[model samples]
Target: MYAIPDSRLPLPQVLDRFPAGVPHRRNHVNDYLLVPREVDYFNGFLALLGRAQPPLQTDQLATAARNLNDVAAGDTPSPCIQQRIQHAHLLEQLLQDRDWEPSADISRELKLVVAYLHASRQLIPDTVPGVGHLDLAIVIDTAWPKLAAEVANFVDYQRLRHLEAERQGRSDDAIAFNRSSWLELREIEARLHEHQRRVREGSYAPEPFTYFRVH
Candidate 1:
């Protein structure tokens, strides 16, 4: 990745000093720079830090930041600041992994995921319960097939089951699996397309073929 020069403070410290409210746009020379979304992520990080008695782990921080962005974007009803902060920390850790060098395909894919998460967050409300979490997972799953196994294991299967139940008109359960299943399916389809493209380009080999004979 093109190394943006390191910020003056460590990620946590920078987050600590983050200011409140939306950031302003600044023009430098001919370039119009929107305030770095990272600033929002950092502010959200601090907010999360304040709520949790113990500081969150790096991975948690990143996830919270992404969540906060989603809340801010109106994707969710407005996730609590604490949740946003935890997500942010998780994202930061993922981005900082030394294995994600700019030249590597994985690094590029990671950046694409971050950008997608950022854009998605901007598109929805942050407070919307579970929007950030679900959307973030969708982005990761779409962008990184290698991580699919982990995601599959971690996803809320009960929620999916509940969604299926709701679709069948069962309101008795009272569990609101309000997540957008259609969107998740669309994301999965997009990932499949991307995987196919990679295989066609010889960037990645196709997985072993599995055939099922319909009885």
Candidate 2:
């Protein structure tokens, strides 16, 4: 079997969807230009994205995100990784939709993005020894900002729900707890947005990476 299939289209056509939010890192790849295999790999992956399957069901995905949160409790994931997780988590919360309901438009958008996130494989398969998540991360990061208002609205809904619960019991300190969670969510959102701003403005960037032929 072919390790990485050749793209149906010419190279330039394949790159059109990429680097939209993924800045061509100031790394060896861009500096030296990409090798033929690397170029073909991207083309192939971009093509496959059109047919990729969902990576996880909503409940399963929520479990995965919660597990990651538990594992990373008190630690940090680099900004790129963190933003990708947060975006997925926010969508998870929306899909759960237990406490807050989104507008029809927001709900559809969240589901679409979440499905994209769940793709078991991508232009770059996650099974790659390293940097497997790069393609997924870049796609989510590109889509992250557009979802901000909905995410913030969901946080607001959570805050109000907890406050209501507090009034009924008015003793569990649910109010305080929810407030803290909201603060944490907003902080992460702010940081992610700032990071995106810097990337777009060309002010700052996370360390660049070498190419892995996108298989």
Candidate 3:
């Protein structure tokens, strides 16, 4: 949960896959960071990527996780691994949430990131022992700076939707409220609470002088 500089975020364990001295590691990381700058090229690359390789199959994922059951070897999966998986799903859900529409650039970028996850081959071959899937984390962390706000807003929208459903005496999942209505409700609630707080506190006033004189 601690913050680190973006440049240093690709886990050290993944970088260790390089030999004691090799420029391949540095070049590989740079490609990820820099390629997104050329919008047309990147988009075309993604299109070709989709056509070139089949999506990661369910069996492939199962094979990757089969090692987790080796209790005798004490191979415990990291909680962060599950968190990353959930985060990927969250990004997908955000794109689909009809109430919150994203900017065109954001929509395209999200599709690229999701497509990267679905692709069978990646910058770092998934077959590598320890750092196989770490590249996926690196890609997500790299894109997170641009995506964090939109994701946060989507989360807030979801929270307010559930609250709105409760207020309407409807099931949380059944409510069909939109973001505009939620925003209006939020503003009105905020103003009313502020007014109530001011009323309860009375007007800001100077302290009254004590009538009784001390002997």
Candidate 4:
């Protein structure tokens, strides 16, 4: 796990402790495409998650998952609501650790992302009629892709562990990796491969993959 600081990046002295420089308050929702600075901010956030250091909190992930808690709904395809709900579900699965255990470092990053999700005075507040979740969406968009592989691996590991224990007639203390998680992990793997293929065949240069895992 990366040793990203538990405290946010310090404000520039000139900003007088204003939160525009803060991760939760940066208001990246103003632009449809990420501006260069927004890119820098999110990239730094990712790097912080990937840093090989002690985790800040394993329990913090629940905070984010709670925000994503869903109300009863019919099968609707509202992208914004559905998208956030999905993101929340992912966080919830990891937080509950039904499948595999994450190291302290991975938990720390997850905690940070959750904290941002639940911030009351974020870049855009939920009180702002239609556009409130934009900031949350943007933050998730920036952060979740990097975590795709780790989530996938954890799910797979749990599945393998289940098999190993079953074969050896050992106790399976961990919850069995379910069909939904397996499917989600497969989808993540497919998307990652497609991304790599694009980098290989397109104009972009290939970069090494990085995430909060130690291995």
Scored by TM-score, the top model is 3
Residue-level error in angstroms, candidate 2, position 2: 46
Maximum-lDDT candidate: 3
Task: For each candidate in the order shown, give its overall lDDT on alpha carbons.
Answer: 0.39, 0.47, 0.53, 0.48
Candidate 2 lDDT, tens digit per residue, 59-82?
222222333334343435334445
Cα error, candidate 4, residue 48 (Å): 5.1
Q: Cα RMSDs of all predictions?
A: 18.8, 21.9, 9.9, 18.4
Residue 107 of model 4: what lDDT? 73
Q: What is the TM-score of candidate 4? A: 0.37
Q: Give per-model TM-scores.
A: 0.25, 0.42, 0.56, 0.37
lDDT tens digits, residues 1-215, model 3? Answer: 21222332223332223233433212232113322233234334534333232222222233223332232123322334434555667888877777667656577667777877788646445444433454465456556656766677677677778788888999866877776766787788789999999978886686688787879
Candidate 3 ranges beyond 4 A from true positions: 1-80, 124-132, 196-215
Better of 1 and 2 by TM-score: 2
Better of 1 and 4 by lDDT: 4
Task: Please list the residue runs of candidate 2 whose C-alpha ends up more than 4 Å from where it truly belongs after superposition.
Answer: 1-77, 127-130, 170-215
User: Candidate 2: TM-score?
Assistant: 0.42
Candidate 4 lDDT tens digits, 1-215: 31222222221121122223334323232222224454455445645655332221211212222233333133332245446545655665666665555555567767777777666535434543334454455455445546555666655655555655686677656445554555565677689999999877886556567766776
